[model samples]
Target: MANGVERELVLLFSEEELREMSGVKRGGEYIEVTCGCTSHRYGDAVGRLRVFINGELEITCECTPGCDEDTMTPAAFEKHSGRETARKWKNNVWVIVNGEKVPLSKTVLLKYYNQASKNGNGSHRSNNGRVCHRDEFVRCNKCNKERRFRLRTKEECRIHHDALAVANWKCADMPFDK
Candidate 1:
């Protein structure tokens, strides 16, 4: 009964017929059907069909003739449309996640790229003296090795060395101080 919604005149199918056709059991506790048309003003017409089940608002599928089956729950739909999540970066870029600029692996970056692209901004590095460029790897201040710096001060670094020397530091626990 909402605006833009129309009641269809299609014949109702029996529970057995619906089950056989779509493998979904009908004759549940609740069922409601609603339809509406989207005014695009350009391109093809878009229609919506909603089905409620068990007294709960359920499936809402969009129909445009050539469109694919893009049916989902409200939570999933919002996440896919980049409306309820943060942007994700891709390709081992330096990104600030939870206030730390860390090198994200390629796998992590790909998962959030599309969402980030829609949010009007790309991945950003934190301002805690961490490198921001994707190609620039972090180098240790003492050894110049391509290792992730843990933001330790000179005093902390010295303490780490002393602890290791006392234990005859094993390679398994090289730089991390206890």
Candidate 2:
């Protein structure tokens, strides 16, 4: 919409070109770093972003569960944004596949989550000033008991998962052999 018109072709913008485009920012690679189409208030006819805690990013469409997500490089993403494609990644808006608007479901994912809650499949998390992971599943050979090392759901599961992939890690749950 640089000229107040929606182009039929996706525009691959250089950093300079993007800086001049609407709903673009100056601090990202491939796609817009600061914002995406899903949450853009300016009505960007492109995909939105979801930056993970580990700095990974994903381009998500404005649809509910199981809806197709558009994946492409920055250039291809802009190309598909054309009105002719029909699969539109409108900013802060809904997705339009083949000229059909894809509505965001208010209960699809929520329904599954509610079911998970009722089953008690993910409702136990206790910290004892140390790690509190499920020991029953991974009982140690020496103690034949569950060891706490940071795998609880409520605790920092993600951080622990990342940190555990190291070459040197001493298990506090492991008893010192006397």
lDDT of 2 by residue, 1-178 (tens): 4332222112333344334333333232323332233322334444554322222334544334554656553233434344334333232223333344333222111111122342255444444434335532234445455445444554446545543454343444333439
Tell me the lDDT of model 1 at 23. 18
What is the Cα root-mean-square deviation between model 2 and the actual structure? 16.0
On a 0 to 100 scale, what is the lDDT of residue 125 in model 2? 40
lDDT (tens digit, per residue) of candidate 1 on 1-178: 3221222211233343223221132223322232222222322222222233212223344444565646654333323333323233122122233334333332122222232333233333455834343222233444545543332455644545454354333333445547
Q: What global local distance difference test value does model 2 have?
A: 0.36
Candidate 1 Cα outliers beyond 4 Å, as residue runs:
1-29, 40-54, 60-62, 73-178
The models' CA-based lDDT, in order, is: 0.33, 0.36
Q: Spell out the clash pairs found in candidate 2.
A: 10-78, 37-48, 37-91, 38-92, 135-146
